[model samples]
Target: MDEVLFRGSRKLEIMQVQAQLVASKTKEVFATYSQATKALISQAIHSNQVEQLKQNIAQLIGYVLEVTRDFKYQVTNILEPRRLWIFFSTVLGGKWSRREVGIACISFVIGGAVGLGVGLIIRRRETIYRYMEAIQISHYLGPEGATVVEDAHAPYECGQHDVLVEVKASSVQIIDAQICCGYGRTFRRILRRIYKQSSSDLPVILGRDCTGVITDLGKSVKRLEIGDEVWVTVPFWSQGTLCQTVLVSEARVARKPKNVGFEGACSIPYAGSLALSALTEANIDFSNAKDKRFLIQDGCTPVGCVLIQLLNNWRARVTTTCYKRALPVAKALGATDIITIDDSHYVRDVHEKDPQEIREGDQKLLLKELEVRGETFDVIVLTRNDCVDLSGFCTKNGRILCTAPEELLSDSCGFFSRLLLTGYVKLKIVIQNTLGLPSDTFDEAHLCHATLDRLTEMVEDGVLQTVVEKVYHPKDIEVALNHVQSPHSIGSTVVTFR
Candidate 1:
């Protein structure tokens, strides 16, 4: 699939290059032809009888129109459907569609547009996707270099199925560091090559989450139109949303939830994708989990917060372990029980699974917090994959949903060895059931689209809330990244790109 998109992009680039060459040559030829034709026709009008001169000029007009029609059909065959659509729309306006019906009088529209030098400038093809103001990072930021330059990257082009958004605001995420510096080391070398330091390459765009107004649309795009306000989490490899204007694929975008403002919408993409994917893919029957114990670790983090809100909406018996500060919001989101992470000693009690689970409780130490009288959690959610081991978290055959890929690795490797040592415990990280591996398989669009749909419902119900800590300007991206990395981060940190 990657290979196919790469080839398609290459093909598009090649046709564009060829079009420029052809348009340039056509202008040169037309200049000479026009000069010579005008000179000869003028002499005939002055020297010959009016009837004869009119006859000669009429023949030249027929020849010119015939040639232009032939060339247009032949050359456009090489152009893709999207480009051809753009070309005709921009150069001919509504006349292209009217061409067949009004074939007899084609010269006024087609010829007039060409005579004004419209066809001679193919670079205008970029008007659909081009933007003047965007955030750009020319090179990877070192451990200390966390700078983002706003007011850069102008006149970008929208490709096929791409939508041009006049960004009202965009937000930052923890992954911005990985994007700015191309800093990541995974088991696979594939991603490292793209994200690694670059000596001579186009600057990488930053910011993935945004809410913006759609000012323009590519020829092939139908899902959205100009004047629509949408929220999107663009693909990391594509252009970043942290710019004055961004060209994004329609598939990765969705209608902004009306309940949230741009500031809140900007923080939903990655975190929401992870949380919702964790719940659905983990195969939890949210409706049926009202009586089951569901443990969510790190409720202080953004992903955990979203999970708690969603699980609570399902009336699931949710128990979260977070810092003392996060307990309020977690509880407000319908967490039936809360446990603090700062306690030295926790009271762990064993209990039998209850059909009617306990509903709500004050914050308690992990050891003192008895989720139930007997059985362990039916589902354990690790917001971050910091679990040293998974043995104590779940009952036998209990499902574990973790956001970390490393946990999946540890779960897979030394499986037999660990099973013998720790006894039998079946644990599965959250997205593994759906994604198989963190990124081993390809997802069609933003993995969060379904989540976004559900988010709309939750927001309308006045139950789901976007956790916001601080909103920063694009120039202060470094501050936002620092906040997200800091233990002091109150909730989600956002960078507003107004």
Candidate 2:
């Protein structure tokens, strides 16, 4: 009975071992199937994601191309000049009768002509209006001579060598005031007659120089074009620049200095030209100016200031005489020495002497003072006739020049008188030369386009500066002229158009 029980136990144990082996194989197969199924599902999902990403990239590229095409199309439409032609072709594609086509062409021609005529008329009227509203002097009435005319005749059309400038800003100079008071009337009248101009050319403009835009160009213009900014110096015999527009010879126009505005630039041309001419007359030039000594009388004047600055630029020593009030201006303009004029005692205390004698005495005293100091200059610039006797202050082989030589010739009335006076003046100059008093007269011909261009370079390089003390509008031109004529006026007085 024990053996049989043991056998049954063994059989039961073997069956249990077989059942356990089968269950292990089944679990292994199911796990392998699950892993393969998971890998396939992951690969399928990755492939679908890659395909979707490629489609999205394609769509993005298409969108960029569409934007580019749209931008190009818009630009082409805007830049195309044939758009009107294309529209006309599309609208008038159908055939029409010969009479209808002729009528259409006639209508177009008439419309264009009318439009052109209206535009020309408007332009002409505007130009006329601007010219009529200019600041002009009908007669020599001093500072109050300048008047704004609303019904004056327009200036003549541009000559072959002329350009029309729309004045932006102009300077009211002492010379302008002097001209208003008939300073150069006789000479200018002579010039007009020589040029065969009408004697009835009244209402003369008074500004000598201006900064402006070129509004019109003559057929012969070469160096300048319309809308170019220019600095212009009008001849004394021509119509001046205080007007809204001025007709200037191309020879008198130069590109304005880039460093300055219209107002600042306006202060330069006349003053710079005058100073340069005076220096040239004195035989002083850029090459020999270094370390040279100069003496400028009435240094508070515009020409005097320019002389000081220009000499300073050339590394020269400059001595100036001015009123006490103008001392600072001289110093700022780089004068090496300043002598203040005290005319109070001479004007007030010398009641017994003649006024002219008193003035001469005062000037002599100044010369004596300089002599006492043993001070001499290589060049002496005499701005006023009162100092014409200052030749003694010049060093050996030095020179004296008059900035306003016209004033010396002003006393003569007729052509013969002027001619004889000029001879006398020449004789006087020769006598002075014999006396070792070297002197020369300033010639306006030296103030030309070349001089202006050189000055523009100096100004742009900061070697020269504009000195404007006051600025006024066109309506206040009278005040500006008065200020320029005032004894206390410093630097330049500018009149702006806008």
Candidate 3:
């Protein structure tokens, strides 16, 4: 009996060793399979084979779900707890002890955990790739002044009255250059503090207008829809349009005219808005402009050209002043009388005069020349700073409109001095209104959706035409900005995404 017991015990020990060997071999096989699978997945992802990776992952998830479903059905319907334990033991050759059973259970748990972790990692990677990355040209205060940043994580969530636009084209204006050089820092800092509650306002984008497709719309937006192409003029104190995308209030956007492309459409918004505001403030509309005489100073400018065309469409007689090189452009825009100026002086006929004399005589000479021809304008639009007081050239009840009011504020003056100057301007306007002076500053026009809508009609009707001097890619943004700062810029400098 002792020898039989010894033989049986030895047989049981050998069976245990064999089971251990089988488990080790199974674990090694699974480990090799997992490593190979991970290698293939990594290669697919790195190679940007997104579709193939997605298909592999999908198949893996489906197989896991089908296996889980079959296991659940068997456990719930065909096996009790005791039978399940027996089934696992039978599957392991029915020679497993309590220790071996525990080991098998642990292996199953670890395998499920590994599978779950892999699925989570793959799902996370897919989630990360789903979002569209944004890029922008941002200005900073330090040595890294302006930079083009990829994956800019600026907040683009739309508000109740806002729209998100995918910018196709934008134009560089004088304001963009000035802001890049730190213009309006103090005022914009105050505004930023109020809005964002942060002290620093350095990293701001610098663009005024753009043409783009609306990618998203706020709940309160009524007239616009996603995918509609539109033109926008961003508010001065807000984030600008020199980026892949921008968020603006619906009130500042209008449908782009069908007659123009993105580059042409972008060139129109800022200048067209200014021209319309100036004309509307001066009470000059299509209804009453027929046969009226108007004069535009520095008529080769973008805003000046827009003004000339709009007035011409109203059947008004347009007199314009420009440098000799810009005369053809001004005339082609429908200026009835083109007064050529020297490159440095406002009057070409006074070019031979002394610097001081030219400064003093150009205005007088031009006015005398106009008077000698019995020419007095019903409206005098000052688009640039001139030594000449064009107020004297308007008819008795004519209006004087200065479109560039910020130029007055740009002079070197203290806060109190500027306040007093502003008061003096108001007093002058009141006096002109009271005494019937020929020159009168128009009230500031509030830019809104209605104004842009009107401008769009004018554009489509062939009344207002876009003048794009040059179109630069975003890669050449610095060149575009520098070009706009040139005093000799004839029209608009546009930057296109494509």
Candidate 4:
């Protein structure tokens, strides 16, 4: 009986040992999975998969430490700050190279080892929040003129307003502020004052229109919650539109169209919505404007293209001006009547011709010459600030939609009056994208969906093209800006962030 009992006990011990082995093997498998995830995340980051890298970095690192080894201390507490600073300088300083990463790592280890070690010993969490660095424009009524300056961006708190939007990417473009029928410079000055008075605590966010997954929800937010990918636009007063983070009212949030990437969709809202608003302000009624003649100045520009596309959608007659070099591109985007204004002979002939000849093109002459002949159109859309003299030539009682300012406002009263006063020649603002606007003041999401959708469609359908004659990386910002300011350039200038 004693020998039999010993054998049975031995069998039970053996089975217990086997169960332990299985558990150990399972953990090893999990550790391997964690390592794979880390490798993938590193690869994604290197590849500039910004959104995916953001999502996976934290969880993968956490899993690796927990399962691979019995790490008693927090690695992040030791490494996070040091790693973050190095990571940031590397990322924001310029495009990432293997050598740069190596240098950053070496410097971090040499300089921040003690701090990182202490942090690791004290920290329990190993995750860091991802944020994009952005440029904030602060305008002050300058001693010389309206001085626009850039400030370091911070975070924004969403008050009880209702909606919040995460920005994917923001489009940065320059417009002729004097002629553009918007209050960008004026509002910028106001924001500068508020920021100055607030001790520079104000957050700078970008993305006039955004398409992203919703990561959090507010208490009053009934329609959205965690994990809902949404597109949001803030109201005009919110300063969160130009940075990596954005907070908006619920009234401004909307669903993103699934077909487009977030980056591609960013400009849509600002460009598309502005067009809609401009049309609304004009009161020409898109549904009734079929077969009517409309003149769109500066057809080579994005806004001009947007205006042209919308008018064409309504099947209106469209006339546009393009430099001879840009004529092909403009035609490709659907310019029916194109006037090449760079030719001196063309200009002189039109100036000398009979007003009637200028009014109606004889097939040999351009439409601008016809305009000199006192030819009037159903709608005249001015896009370039310097394209035409606003003080002259607009037909009395003819509808005029302008995106740029013809002259600088001498004072606030004149500025406000021009914006408020309505006349025989109606002035309307048409913008498709909104960037660098305060979110606290305007509804951003509604504008994004309403405008961005149309803008994307125009691009995809070949109605709009990014005449990106040049691409300047983030580090080349100064060079790009200077180049753009030069007297002559055939195409539009753009800066891209990598």
Give the best candidate by TM-score: 2
When 1 and 3 are scored with TM-score, the better candidate is 3
Q: Write the per-residue lDDT of candidate 3 for residues 7-27, one digit (tens) a residue.
A: 999999999999999999999
Q: Write the per-residue lDDT of candidate 1 for residues 204-294, one digit (tens) a residue.
A: 6667678888888888987777897787775454556777777666666667777778888766666777677677766765666666778
What are the per-residue Cα lDDT tens digits for candidate 4 across 362-481?
223444476575656777776645433432444566687775423434225365563453221121111222444333312223354445445555656655444444554434434444
Best by lDDT: 2
Instruction: Give lDDT per model, in order.
Output: 0.64, 0.78, 0.75, 0.54
Q: Give Cα distance to truth, residue 236, candidate 2, Å.
A: 1.7
Better of 3 and 4 by lDDT: 3
What is every candidate's alpha-carbon RMSD to the true fold? 27.3, 22.0, 22.6, 28.6
Q: If scored against the real structure, what TM-score would every candidate get?
A: 0.58, 0.63, 0.60, 0.50
**TM-score (C-alpha, index-matched) for candidate 1:** 0.58
Q: Can you write out model 2's per-residue Cα lDDT over 1-498, one digit (the tens) per residue?
A: 999999999999999999999999999999999999999988987897878998999999999999999999998996785774455556788465557767888999999999999988877554433335578888888778788776655555778888888889989877777777777665566445544454633657878899999988889989889998999886666678887778777888999998799998887899889888777766787788999988888877778878899898888999988767788888999998888777566546656776667667667767766877788888888765556477777889988886753563563477788666546655765686699763333225655688889989989998888988899887888898877754456788888886
Q: After superposition, how far is residue 255 of candidate 3 from its true place, in Å?
A: 1.2
Q: How many clashes show up in model 2?
A: 0
Candidate 2 TM-score versus the reference = 0.63
TM accuracy, model 3: 0.60
